[model samples]
Target: MEQPAATYPVHGPSLRKRRMALGLTVQEAADKAGISRSYLQRLETGIRERMGPKRYTRLRTALNATNDQISPPPEIPTEER
Candidate 1:
């Protein structure tokens, strides 16, 4: 039998939704993603908006999330030095 495609929650555009969908606590998800809990929390709460490729890949891999299920990291503005 073909397995059904995984569907992550779309209630909100934050990592928290995906974490909650999988019934994983922040610490658990962070550990799985190989990141600090505070970093993950920042991403979930929109305290931070951009993620580097390494971090993004880690989160996606940890969550087993499809491209659509995860929000792409928005481009960060260059500092006006």
Candidate 2:
């Protein structure tokens, strides 16, 4: 059988959306969050999984996101899927 594409563990508030709302560019936001633009880009695009919790927290703060606004509980993957 053909396996399905590997989706991320969860869908969360997009960093890109919030950054746009705040009128910030990826470079600007990444600078504020003390990360590289490419890293932020990856996070926004879901190309990276499991950004470090501490760094994620910093990013949430830099983006001025409330816990409810940003945190998406991870989806548990089932073996038989």
TM-score against native, each model = 0.69, 0.68
For candidate 1, write residues 8-66 as lDDT tens digits. 22212556778888999999999999999998887777667667667777888888886
Quick one: how many clashes does candidate 2 have?
0
lDDT measured at residue 78 in model 1 versus the true structure, 0 to 100? 97
Cα shift from native, residue 59, model 1 (Å): 0.5
- Model 1: residues >4 Å from true position, as ranges? 1-12, 72-81
Q: Supply the global lDDT for candidate 2.
A: 0.72
Name the Cα RMSD for model 1.
Answer: 10.2
Every candidate's lDDT = 0.74, 0.72
Please give the TM-score that candidate 2 achieves against the real structure.
0.68
